[model samples]
Structure formats: structure tokens, C-alpha cells
Target: MDQDQTYEYRGYRLVAKPADNGARCWAWRDGVPVHKLIGCDVPDAIQRTRNAIDSDLGVAARDGDAGDAAYTRALEAVLPELSTGQLKMLQARYRAPDRIITATELAKAAGYSNYSGANLQYGNLGKAVHAHHPVDLPVRSNGTLVYTCALADSPDLEPSATEDDSHWRWRMLPSLAFALCALGLVAK
Candidate 1:
């Protein structure tokens, strides 16, 4: 390829090279090299390089289609009571790869100051989840903590599940909930 040509995948720029029988690749931005990899074949090398660039472009945590769908569904359920601006701020929490909103934080968003008290008067977001089907719980970034509103009257929600779909769900008394749920109170 010509030096004038550039490969843009996700948000980073990659430089392509041809090896004896395959392709080699690297990425740079502002003179900083972020990744270097050798692919088994030319196409494989290009794909690998593109994937590396994409994964590193602040989307290290790529959500599966199911995760994205869950986000949209939950947002639809949570947005009606929120002013457009309020919704925007909450959306920002999910904008980056690793932001977590606690129950306390979400409580404030719902206009409740007490961490335990919920603002679930009729037509409120909380009320909707409790009244009907549960929304898919959002996955947390590796170190984030947030409460899920899935269980009734419980202040606990599960953290992000691993690739195998295993995680912890806390209850009102985290210890007790942990004890019982640890024994298998949560849905798999």
C-alpha cells in the first residue's frame, strides 16, 4: 500500500507492513506506538491489526449485542421521568468504558436524598421496573459498583458478570445476602 494511504479502524491509525509470507502491523497516534502484532497471513494480519486498534480506542470493553440491547431497553425505561438534560448526564455515565452509578447515586438522580429511600411514586422509573418485567441489569466496568433494581425491596444488585456469566448479587444486608445468595439465590 502507498504511504499516502491510511487504515482507520475504530479510532486509531495503523501502519501496515508485508513480511516474508504474511503481514505485520502497528499503530501510532501523535508519534506514540500503541500496538504491534504479526498476523499469520496478509488478510489475517490486517484484521488482527484493525482489531487491536479498535479494542484500544477507548472501547476496550466492547459490549455484546445483547449488552447494547439491554442498555437501550433500560434507558427507555429510565428516561421518561428524567428531563432531557438529566438523561444526558446519566447517558454520559455509560459513555465511557468504565463508569458505575451506585444505588445511592441513582437515588439522587431520582430525587431521593436518602440512599435507602426510593422515589418510586407511580410513573417513576423504579415503579415501572417493579410493576412489570425486569430490565436487563447493566454490566459494570471491572472496578465499578452499582445496585441493580431487579429484586424488590433489596438494596443489592449484581456486579458485572465475567465472560462465563458469573458474578455477585448483594442484598439489603450485604453480608447476609452474600451468605444466602452465595449459596445460590441469584439467577444464573
Candidate 2:
């Protein structure tokens, strides 16, 4: 039987509808559709939505904030699980001005022939991070089970600045950046 489970987090209302394949989840803020996802399960759906709220759409740690400890720990836990391509993509974002990067640019930086590869790798990396810490949000698709979320800031939608700008551009969180530095994952 399909049941609609409703929840509230970070001032957003979440509804998860379970199906044969998985759960379809949605989040609304101030009655506006802010995000959606097809999660592997009901809890996964809700957790993913909560993750988005806790990290991406909310105020994360700023420079030198002690509140960043959780993000730092999560990144450190997931570091060993990242592939070279994934690490490269993260390094590129780390080196980018203000830590903001587009998927296409990240693909090129990580030596992937296409953005699709970068999306997959990055999304998978997001899963790894999520495994270590559920609070780290990874963007999920409303339509498919594809991993499009990267282990970075949720993403700032920049509409129509360019063909690429139409996509959600990511900014690396300060905690993740500092974690990379602390672990010597990126060159100083």
C-alpha cells in the first residue's frame, strides 16, 4: 500500500510517497517547490531532503567557525572512498575562485571526456559522503535514481548566463575545503 508520509524540516515541508521502485520525495519552502527526489526508500527520501535542508539551503559554517567540525569529520571519513577522478573534480572545485564550479568545467578539470561522467562520479562521491554523514546533502533526481548530487554545496541556480549556466552550479563548502587541506589532499 502506498502511503504519503509528511514531515517538516528546516522550515520546509516534506512528503514521501512510497512506490514499488522507491519513494518519491518533495520539499517545499514557503509553499514553493524547492526540491524533489526519487530515493531508494522512504527513509532515504526523507533523509536526503533533510540533508538538503541541513547543509545546502541553510547557512553552513563560515570561515573559522567551530561548527564546521561535523562537515570536516564527514569529509575525512569519506576521503578514502573517493576515486581519483572524484578527487580531481573536488580539487578543481577547491582551486576554483570562491570554490564554485560547473559540472562541465569539473568534467574537463577531472579529465573526463564529458560532463555525464563527472556527474556520475561526483554523484557517487556524494553517496560516499552521505554514507559517512547523512547531513551532507546530495542532489537527487525527481525522475530517476541517477546520482547527480556532488559532495559540495547544494548548488546555486544561475539561469541562462550561458548554456552551461542553465545547470546547477556548485560551491565547495568551507568545511570540505578545509578538510582537504588538513589531509593534504590538495596542494598548498
Candidate 3:
């Protein structure tokens, strides 16, 4: 029974009721209806359904795995600043429909080492975010299910000196006054 379950794509769901007779049709993961063959002249329907199923399974499996891997990386990155409970809190808050999760949120929720840790060295905290390595899990809460977890851009990878370019900063102590002012905060 796909009822009460979320497919999150193609709008597939279980439909117990049927329009023509008692012949129910699966959401086909979308508006399409999945049914039995009526005649040889009504060809290609079964094969097409099979193809859709296969394609859906293939993509879901691949993407799901990658999301798991990326999460591993994210965990490694978050570990430096947050306790496990905090990390879980983030998952509970984010990773649902209409929510756009980002590295910054992960860092904050996990108590990242600093404000910009999401885009800095020692940020990735892992080797890499391989494709299809993350498997997004749906957690049940208050009888509600939602999507959580993401996979991509290894959280373990150190922020290289290349993500940002052409934007640079420079400073100058044009006079002794400026130098003294800058050093005012230093030890006497």
C-alpha cells in the first residue's frame, strides 16, 4: 500500500479505487495508470510500465546511495564542533519537502567550528562524496514522514584555495599612525 507513503517524484502513490470497474491502477509514480493487458492490439503498455519501473528503481537506488556518502562526509565535518544530538536535531528540522538544505545550515546545526567552516579548510572532513553513496532516509514523526539526508560535495574535503577566485583582500599601513593603531590591541 503506497498510501500515506511519499514517492517525492513523478507523483507515484497507491490508489485503491479504480475508475473503470474494480481494476485499480498504481500511481505509476505519476498520473499514469498501471493495469493489465486487455488485448494484443493494446500492445507496448506492459513493456512501457516495466521500463518505467526499472528506470525509477535505477535512479532512486543510485541517488539514494550517493546521498548517504555525502552525509558521512557532513558528519565528519560536523563532529569537530557539535555533539551527536545536535546533529540529529538538524536532520529533524531540515531535509523535508520545500526545504532547501545547505552546508551552512549543517555547520550551524552541528555547531561548526566557525562561521565559515562550511567553505573552509578542514570543512569537508572526509575523502570525497562519491556518486550514489548516500541513501536518503525517511523518518517517521507524529505519523508524518519526511525526507532527510543528502550526498554530494564531500564534507571531508578541505576548503581548497580555489573555490573563490578574483575576490581578494589587501591592506596597508601607510603611516606610523596606522601601524600603531593596528597594534593597539596587541600586548603592551
Candidate 4:
């Protein structure tokens, strides 16, 4: 077998390599294998890997559409209420190479000198949205507010001895991303 080629796309790390029949690819998040595919060729394998990742992220609809109508409407309803800083943070997350961003990175994107400002605004963003629509949002067992849950997916990580906000990461929800595009907040 030749050396495996790794590619990062939309927050997933894809590894592609040769197989007996043709090629194989795997999608990984935070170093854990989440999905796999076998293709007739290397490029096919890579494309299939990307498709799987996008489908899991909800960015790629299995039925050849952009998003679910109800979910997109729900996100659009809350988007108008987001502050400029929060919107910028979301845009930054969407543009991130791997689509994952930390609080400090979000602060920088939102023009805040400190992460605290971003943190506060993010929490408020989530609180407001959760107050109205409580479905499909991630919940934490610790009772602490995980603001990222409202609009983003958190990295899959083992619970550490101490939870650190500075190290936390967020990836924008696909539904929200599509809504943002529909609302002209970002390009489609």
C-alpha cells in the first residue's frame, strides 16, 4: 500500500488510500473514524468521503436539495435577531478551513479584543433562540449553558477534568448556513 493521502474539508479529515479492488476513504472527526466508503478509484473514494461528511453535517441533502423547509424557516426566524458580532462570528465559522472555530477566533472575527465579549454575545444568541425554539439543540448534562449548541456542533471530545471555554470549538449548523445564504448574509 502507498502512503495515505489526507485532506481536510468542512471540518472533516479524509484519508484516502489504495485498496485491493480500487480505493478506500474514511471520514474522521477529532481523530475518530465516523464514516467510510469504497470507490472504484481514488478520486471517487475522495468524493464519496466528502459527500458522506456533508450529508452528516446536513449541508448536503440526500434528496438533492439544500435544506429542510421547516428547519430553514426556523433558523431564518432567529437569524434576524442576531447581533452584528454574532453574525460575524457565524460568518467566520462558515469560512473557516475546517469549519471549526474557537472562542478567541470568534472574538477576533467579531472585532472583539477579548474572548469574553464573544462569549457573552454567543450565550445571549443561544439563549434568545432557545427560548423560542427548543428543538434539535444540543444539551449538556452539567447544567451549564453551552451556547454553541444552539447554532453549532461541538467537537466530539472526552470529558476533561476541567471544562475550558477557551478551548471550546463550534461549527455552524448546515441549516443555519443555508438560511444565512438565503437571507443574503453570505454567498450560497
In candidate 1, position 164 carries an lDDT of 20
Q: Is candidate 1 or candidate 3 better by lDDT?
A: 1
> Between prediction 3 and prediction 4, which has the larger lDDT?
4
Q: What is the lDDT ranking, best to worst?
A: 4, 2, 1, 3
Global lDDT scores for all candidate models: 0.40, 0.66, 0.30, 0.68
lDDT per residue for candidate 1 within 1-188, as digits (tens), equals 42322476655677777666445777767778888776433333454565456566654322112222343354455545545434332333222122333444444554655434432321244334333434334445874212333321222234434322122222221121222222332211
Pairs with backbone N, CA or C atoms under 3 Å apart (clashes), candidate 2: none
Q: What's the TM-score of each model vs. the native?
A: 0.28, 0.55, 0.29, 0.58
Return model 1's CA RMSD, one decimal: 16.8
Question: Which regions of candidate 2 fall more than 4 Å away from where they truly are?
Answer: 1-66, 136-150, 160-167
Top candidate by lDDT: 4
Residue 115's lDDT in candidate 4 = 80
Sorted by TM-score (best first), the order is 4, 2, 3, 1
Query: In candidate 4, what residue range of length 10 has the lowest lDDT sum?
Result: 60-69
2 against 4, candidate with superior lDDT: 4
Q: Which candidate leads the pack in TM-score? A: 4
Candidate 2: tens digits of C-alpha lDDT, residues 1-188: 48798888778899888867657789988889788975445654565566666666665432222324565677788877778898899889877865778888889988999888888888788767656655523334664332333256534545324555325577665556656666678754
| Cα deviation of 119, candidate 1, in Å | 52
With candidate 3 superimposed using the best TM-score fit, by how many Å does residue 121's alpha carbon deviate from the native?
A: 8.2
- Model 1 C-alpha lDDT versus the unseen true structure: 0.40
Model 1 TM-score, 2 decimals: 0.28
- Per-residue accuracy of model 4 over 102-140 as CA lDDT, tens digit each: 888899999999888998988887677556555444457
